[model samples]
Target chain A: MSNPSPALVRFQTQKSLAHRLTLATLTGRPVHISQIRPSSPTDPGLAPHEISFLRLLEAVTNGSHIEISYTGTTLVYRPGLITGSSPGSGASGGVIRHELPAGCTRGVSYFLVPLCLLAPFSKAPINVLFTGSGVITSATPTGDMSADSVRTAILPLYAQFGISNNIELRILRRSNVGAGGKGGAGEVHLVFGHQVRLPKTVHIMNPGRVKKIRGVAYCTGVSASNNARMIEEARGILNSMTGDTYIFSDVSSAAYLPSKDKSNPNQKRKTGVGFGLSLVAESSTGSLYSADLASPPAGGVPPEDIGRQCAYQLLESVSLGGAVSLAAATTVLTLMAMGSEDVGRLQLGRDVLGSETLICLARDLKAFGASGWGVRDANTGQEGDVVVSVVGRGVGNVGRKIA
Target chain B: MEKARRMHSTQKKYRISDFARLIYDESLAPAEVVRKWRGEDGMADLADDHGPEEAVEEDENFFRKAKHNDDDGNNNEDRLIPKYDYDTLAQKWSNPENLESLRQRFTTANLMKERNG
Candidate 1:
């Protein structure tokens, strides 16, 4: 019932907004971010998608306070209690539904990344229904996160932390930007069961050799033939490296299409339709690395290029030679920093050591009173791998009931 | 116009530091700040030497130091732009020597006996 003290952490510009907000929620400490592109020439402020993200964060947390300057550059956030599914809380079973119309700007992975980190510590189960851009496209351009990448890459990484059984991420519909037709705005549902215990420590020293590669080639409003073409081209490149490669073709039926008939005025309007290719390679040690590409409306990049580019991206990720892909490593590290008081170690590609995402993650961890360190593995040397270790602050789910 | 210009300049003069202090004083809960400060300083040390009262003073000092350092850091530029060089990555992967180095990652290549055994 007593008020928690506030900590002032200042950020110079608009960077890692999601990580900053997520850490503030977990630590229950207010954050003050200033400057926020104060040096930009024109129209400088929080983007519309960032505002939508803030609204989504506010919708989930109870009694959270947010302040912004008139120019929308600086922001001050005081996070409220992270009451998940606790009874008598405003959210029932800690389940909340957020309808994001313009979510296409950032893609669902932007929100999903942080939600995955906070879900295990919620007082109750957390369920979210997101509707917007489902697959990454040129317009949405998977800015370091995408639904396909999250599903194919991140879920397996979470399993190593012992937080796997109750988590579900299902895609109800798929859509792309500027793909006009009957079915557009993608729909995805995520559910997380409450955690009785904090995440377990993990040691991923060697990501065994990749054994097989699998993928999903899906199409909506466009011709289903686009899916087949992508699969053929992608397999052509991957087969040279591994013979056991299978990319399945998936076409959404009319039922998954958004209701656009004038008779049903209240129904959500379809955005557009297109096709996409998502590929994931599984290593013998259960690590997953993934890549994806999507076609825009007619006159965009050719299907062959999309497929070839995706294949090369996968090759790039694999060649980095780590236990997990560069995309999922940040999520795994964030969860490790927020887990129980034990040391967590992971082997990541050398490239990730200098990534902006990792740097922001380190800053966010510091904000949460946790520290993480990365060093080259002595056995393999610099080019081989970078091992990161973090000792969790033992942050408990205060919202959970004592059984 | 002169009055409006004067108002704008005055607002800008307040600076981010002043706004941060205002938010900290008005929004932050006193107890949460101490707990966060102690957590950052390591609870074991706090438990050993000082009581909660002294921890509050330490928290204030931490805030002042944080504010002082905020003005000098120009670390935001690289953080805004992605650092991945895809062209170089493509070139590296295209190299025959590099491809040979990772041949063991595939199923056709022989797996290490210790791993499979």
Candidate 2:
């Protein structure tokens, strides 16, 4: 094409009053046009209602709308393209079932648009919803009623599934549809979502998963008086986890202090941030002692001292979200990036998530105790309910690398 | 004599901040993952103190005593020591001049030679 004159180029660059009006008509909303020359001094903009009507007409002509009902409440939603009704909807009671018969054209001009507007905002309880008919009968360039009707029919279903929107869906200049004579149809896409929080008193089949990883601070001491100091430190740490703190003693100290190596400092000095690392320095206290974190003792002492306390507890893990072993010692590197200090020494093998590899570790940590694992996929970004069952308690058996 | 004195001073200067970084850096992995792993209260601070600058020499001496000499399976000294501290491993790690000696400090060949000798 020959280079256009500068005046013509400037004219093309400038949006005319008619172009502005058309855009307002298409948008279905009042648009404040500014900074450009008003083509005609007498032409103030189209009336707000008229502009809305024009946009709605364009939407019906080029796009489409779909009203869906589920469990008594009806929802009118629009999609980006004309696909089809969402899965499982077309087969049974769906948007199509709820709509009026196709032949009813009495309100095609005025009432149809009103119905389209009402479908989305309707709060009617819907037990069995069906697709409403006559959602897409509109004027088109080709003027083929049959073609327009089919486009209108398929477009709403697509919109319900999040495919299309606007009854007058426009096909762009380079659209893929061949021989663009009244061939433009909008597509819709849809997805359903629900959210439910766990009950305060959850009925977990096993309590092992219920045990949150605990944070503890302990200073070992032999004498009773010194043992008390350890309790103070442990209690301080535990208090930070949650106000409701408790202490229990098992004949086997291993449950509390997994690495109580009296000889190796690496093992003996197992100052952990998990469940308190404690030893019964004396036998006076007993086997079980619990403390409500919210209500600590007057002297900031652990409410109950079960036995010769070697350490005190402040916090514990309620869930083993995830854990992973990373290459290049990245576990520590990542934690450093997250900001250190808040996380202390990980219980040599405590499970954690959001850092390192969270996908499988959280599930495997479940296997550490009596509970079975619910392994989600390894790709952290992927979503869906994919919990695989592990065979047994997770110690000896190499955990299946669940994706 | 000057070198020995300088060495003694260098040893004394080994603050907890230095050793804190090493242990704290290592602690970061677990600390970051388990939000509660590091105590919400300043525990994460200690975890980050693993850098060499945070090492407290005196603290290390005491921590070493506590780690190596807990009174025969029962050290009941209620003396509070920060959970993590660096030990005076018999290497020249604290001083750059001593790095040459430190380089040979942990070599397998040197270890074998020492054992043979």
Candidate 3:
């Protein structure tokens, strides 16, 4: 047979789409661009969302395609070991507007892991007081997400699914009290969050699957009255939740109240009550849910907006972490927020506020700028129910400018 | 020398940390803190030996009020009872002057949360 056709030499090859998916996987050093597409297309941005859909389709059919974005901000560092000085610049902000080529997979390898690692480092505990409500303006480009705005937007979703047997809600009000009496402009921000406890049978795909839930956050501010006498009265009113009394620290330690009672200097201030609410809900996704504001204090300015802003912020914080798999984070955050009692627990008396000085010995302690540290129980490490004194100091070069 | 030794034993240097520890331990305890500059061990010792000078009278008055006359267990228990209960008992021991009816208002608010969970 003609010498068996010289042992007919035929070569065949089978390639897999995993070469594309290699980029999306959380791994060190993404795949090289040349290995997959090996060539740059003339027009990459054609049908943007469709391209993503197609890549996803290819991933599902022929394995998976590594996803990359073209519209991201460009991040560049002067070739050196030193980390760049300004991380705030828009560089490396988002995926660019073009179709992420299979070649960009290599960049993904370098980027994804560090992002996952550093996400926790970006946020430290912050103690803020809501003095009044203000608009949360958008900072970045249109597409760039603003957490504060996202939080404000999601409050309706959470409120609609109110707290139930499976839900536990807690709210914290961070108000910025002013030096002037009540009429002085003060901002009050509300943080509302809830937790929903779920039974084991809900998630059967995996026995160890965690239950999912949602939280709401919002912020609002109101100007206090300038009447000094009323301000003092308001200041004397203790937080209904925590019996702690607050003193008005006027600008320049000046006790002059605009709404001062001419007869009695001590009666110059008015007190304002800041309100916060916590809400939590959990269910198997299609449960009809309903809720309303809990019994609020009778007749003063109702703290309706502050409560909404708080719930909004919490939801945004969770969403930024990830679209799904956010339940564990919500639980941890709820626990952290509820971990301590507010100043509301202490009954105010001059004797209780005795001249007590607390000298804290901080070794290897790190603090964000001006963040107040509560006097926690030394042995148990829980926050003490009472805050007798607060002292903090930091020194910076005279010439340094605060951003 | 014996008086000085006694003074020293009763006195303790007052530091913010020490006061903080005391305050955290119990909010009601009146802790006299005499601020001593760092490295001033001698001053600290002196302050410890002779408790707070300025607040001595105030301390005495407080101690006098806190002084319990008898160590009887029943007396202590009677004193430990809430003031509202004490006022009712004071009118007459075992007096059925409609005293027992007032005790129901002190029901615990968290009874449901603990029970439901």
Candidate 4:
């Protein structure tokens, strides 16, 4: 291709690579990210997980060009058309599958979250299966980035923006990594149907109080009793908070195959079992928030502690009192900015205003030309809520194939 | 006067070079530079550095907040609910006032006056 125009945006450091990439893909803009931990003593530049994430991005788009400095401290990305499916492949009803053995560093949210933003605009249906140890781990010590969070929190938030149908997330296997366990080995499947109907406006000003709680306690390659014990303890805590509480016990063996035989699981098993708990609380207005905890393979944590910890995390999310959890705000803000041309409004907890993720999101949105944005404290002058407004850029899907 | 305003509007269009300079400028810290770009003076020329101490502090805060999640041991106890403390949390939830405050979230609760009965 002819030499393209210079990059339209530049940032130093390694913050929000996923956000920047997603924005660039949507706007067809080139971005240069530099000084990505250039001064760190040991193993600076892009982490292994980041390189894996970039591979996923390159797989989805056509003609995308990614240039990295030899030192790995700088990156320049020229986005190609978001050809959701491989070129020349007509839209097929069968789900398009992409699998990644995500290194045990970052959780699947690192990839799944951006997919949630891009899938709706894809030309064909897409299914992603991420396998690794840290698929559920979050940057937040107490927060979770599990597939359950995507189902309970992220999907529901997308629904408010008129993306209710054609999306599903399933946790096929649960693997616990880190202390008291083997290492991160789990499996999650996410399917996105083609066609995301953009909303004309979003006005979720009030997130009603949580009404009920539900959850899944899952175990793989571990004792079945582990799942039951976790559910029992977690319910003991949730029951006191609300009458409507239910936690399910799920035991599956498909996620524990040895890495050598992951594809053909008939091979000898070489790994130990894993166990974890995931919880979701639903508010009266249909908002959902979630949390999860996993036990290490060797020095296992008490099932009761895992249960209680997950429950407390759910309670903390509810107490934050927003239509969506702080973690889900990034997706919310991105969708709002990408919606049809009109003002979209969201009432979020004060924590979102101060969150580095949201701050970076605001900066990225400005870079994308959605400059007419504002944040105002709630009218009551209380710390309860903050109202955020942004004018959508009316970004439509250029990759959608004509039926 | 009209010509000047029109010229200023055209210049307001964002360019990658501007963002690069804003970030790489050694004199002003990154956060301060970001603030200026987001401030009312959208694209005004950068001001001279305000000493190294302030820049260092602002830069540290920016990176600290950004790395909050990545640092495994840097736990923000204030934000996390203590694990395994079910009894106290359960008791807190059982409070009558607490239950009442959240009652509106249930279907059995009365609808707002704005909605028709």
Candidate 5:
């Protein structure tokens, strides 16, 4: 292999750590991040989800190396080849089952989103089951969207790049946040059967008018009436705009997990007992805008507020006026940056471009030796839309290159 | 001392821009999500210069005032209810003139446009 020892990319703080690690894995570059919550008096290191994510990366890859400082404030990670679920490398029966500890506060989509970015370039098919107590399948107040939205909104974008076959995100069991917002006992299974050497370069500039709106209203361990109330309230606002609006309802019982009480060794308690709504609007040109809202863990607000607020959020996303919503710009742009050598063009709204996440992602891509993006005003019918042209690194699927 | 001063200056520089990231209000830093929309303040440059004629023409009489129907044998005559009811009454859009006022609205516009002519 050429360039055996590439220079390590240096970063600071825990901001956008997920994207940074994803970029490193995609480009096979090593990263050294410092000052991860250095000043938090009580908890000053990498959070629980971050550690679990590192373990997940190791499970899917062949030879990744992750080293943390003594206080856990600093980390040096050398990315390995994404072996996926091939035989003999920590995968049993062609599937890797990764468990999150009881203390994880993030929703499972927190891990699923970044891991999906790594799937297309893997050497083999990626199949992983995320289970255990910390797997909150619904969106939390932490801004990690629900798994339903991941299946509905985020996965469909891969089809534009031509990597959309046999991919599935099955929410085996639904769960919301448990008491005090710590964890939930949920289970999710993901299968990415399509592995590509290079994703097709895409030039998407048209954000057509949203023609149809679809949603999922789900409640666990709560009254089925909660789902109807959320659907009714959301539809009350959305139905007037788009005639082709339908919200499906899913009601399930809470997950029963074993309790840690020593006195009653056989104790079982129900966890993740709340309701949430995930709404998605699909444009005529296959663009998706999504909104997610769930009842808070403390449980005082009504389901109606969640529905109405989520409907307003969907309107806000549509009003952003771009080919990609703010929630999806990072994924689409990252895939564009890692595509074949030709430049791919994407039209983004002014607000999405000015967002801190996208700006930092562009900078990080340049730091990882990818070419700079060319930004110019798009002359599309929409106002204030800018076209970003990303020249790909042309380095994709090193495992395929070797094999 | 130098490190402390440098940290303070940098913090001041990036205070507002940092809030654009999608992070919940961690108990430590506590950034508030302001629900106060800019539309509530109206358009800044377009607020004072607008004429009153644009306001006078929005006669809420023609639209169907389909909010909170009352059974007290009274109706809001301000919204133009029609004289007679068809078998399939176009109760959808017509507010008649004879029905007495059922309730009063507290909006600023309601003060000027009283019950009926």
Candidate 6:
């Protein structure tokens, strides 16, 4: 808090902006990112969703400063303490209400996942209620997972880091993407009550056999039969592989959004009508792999297609054969890096390790002054599973350190 | 220590192989992972995969969950016990593709591939 004009970590491009910001927040560093969509001519600068995320960061944190250029092409951010819904910091009743403006195409997970990484380090319990027209709970074509997947697949992973208690991702109201993939009238509540001094250093080399499969088939503003059809098709494909499979059905009415027409501004219109599926396969050793698929807002594909494709996607994730799936790799690795000053090991599939996103994250960590990861081949039953050893930065929860 | 000492005094003999697990699959309880075929064009009935050894280590809850999959009684498609030919398994021991598929199937990949359909 005493440092003035801290050295800024310079980065280029809008790609992985959220993760870069997340790293900066965790490391208590300043960042200057330029050329955010500068190449695009028609509509340039930071996207709407990115701006929403920056606003969210400002809400959950205290004293964080952000400066965007006139064109929004260049930006500088000086991160502050993760206050997390404390009193007198724009939080009402221990809750930070973050609203997404209209024209946001990404799903709510785009915000929730990044916010989760920041929550554990916050000064107080983090409870954020996302209520807005732009919160698409369902998976979008943009590849963000459904809110259900974030709950079932991703949130449970915090337990491994000893940050498990009082964490809940409640989907108060569900909605799929509206027309033009712009918005959904959904309400989601995230409670991250546990703040730890340091995450437990872990060694997860064994990806045991997936023993059971649990999932949710949800339909909003559509016939409940859509859930049935999806479950049937998915179960049909997955049953023969392993008999222990159960998919729950959730049917909800469509979200009512205020009409945009100037003539009847008060009139409500039904929007974000769709169905989706989220499946999580849990291994005997507590490893989780998840898959999500939702019908497009344009609406033509049958529920069977979504179900079958999602089942295949789950199978594909399982086939990756690692202690961590690609979806959870970033979280697992980041937590490991923020852990105690010791080496933590995680076994990941070769493809998962070689993925561009993971590679970029490794480099970004290096830029943020974290130790390099040590990769060695795992001689386990599964072929090509590499064990990545990360030495922790030992700078976990700066607020917790002082308090 | 007491249990091992008492076991040592018994008439039964102990071996190192029994104490040492060769693989993670052998060490874990039988939760029944789906078999994935890795682009094998040949039809292989690799049912011994979840052989009698897994039957010994099977979780009762998992076994029960395996049995009661019927939302409706008409769903008789669940095979509680699958029948496999031990002869074919022995005959294919030397087959490279069978061994390769077995290795691939055990790990979590290429499950219920479209090749079968």
Candidate 4's residue-wise lDDT over B89-109, tens digit each? 555555666555554454445
Q: What is the DockQ of each candidate?
A: 0.11, 0.01, 0.01, 0.09, 0.02, 0.02
- Best candidate (score: lDDT): 6
Quick one: best DockQ, which candidate?
Answer: 1
TM-score of candidate 5 versus the correct structure, residues matched by position = 0.79
Off by over 4 Å in 3: A1-25, A31-279, A282-403, B1-117
- Candidate 4 collision pairs: A133-A184, A180-A296, A180-A297, A180-A299, A181-A296, A181-A297, A181-A298, A182-A297, A221-A273
Per-chain TM-score of chain B, candidate 4?
A: 0.26
Order the candidates by lDDT, highest first. Answer: 6, 5, 1, 4, 2, 3
Candidate number with the higher DockQ (1 or 4) = 1
The positional error of residue A120 in candidate 4, measured at the CA in angstroms, is 1.1
Whole-model Cα lDDT of every candidate shown, in order = 0.64, 0.24, 0.23, 0.63, 0.77, 0.78
What is the clash count of model 2?
118
Candidate 2's TM-score: 0.16
Fnat by candidate, in order: 0.26, 0.01, 0.00, 0.11, 0.00, 0.01
* Root-mean-square deviation of candidate 4: 10.3
- List model 6 lDDT by residue over A1-403, tens digit each: 5776679999887768988899999999999999887756766788888999999999988999999999999999999889999999999998889999778888899899989999999999999999889999998877788999999988999999998999999999999988988889899999999999999999998888777899999989999999999999999877766678999999999988888898999999988899999999888889999888899889998999889778767766776678888888998999999999999999987656655466667778888988878877788836656788999999999998988
Comparing 1 and 2 on lDDT, the stronger one:
1
lDDT of 2 by residue, B16-75 (tens): 232223222333333232332222222324435555443454345445645663343212
- Mind giving the per-residue lDDT tens digits that candidate 4 earns over A270-306? 3425667878888777777777666644544788777
Cα shift from native, residue A267, model 3 (Å): 30
| Cα-lDDT of candidate 1 | 0.64
Q: Going through the candidates in order, what is chain B's TM-score?
A: 0.25, 0.18, 0.22, 0.26, 0.15, 0.20
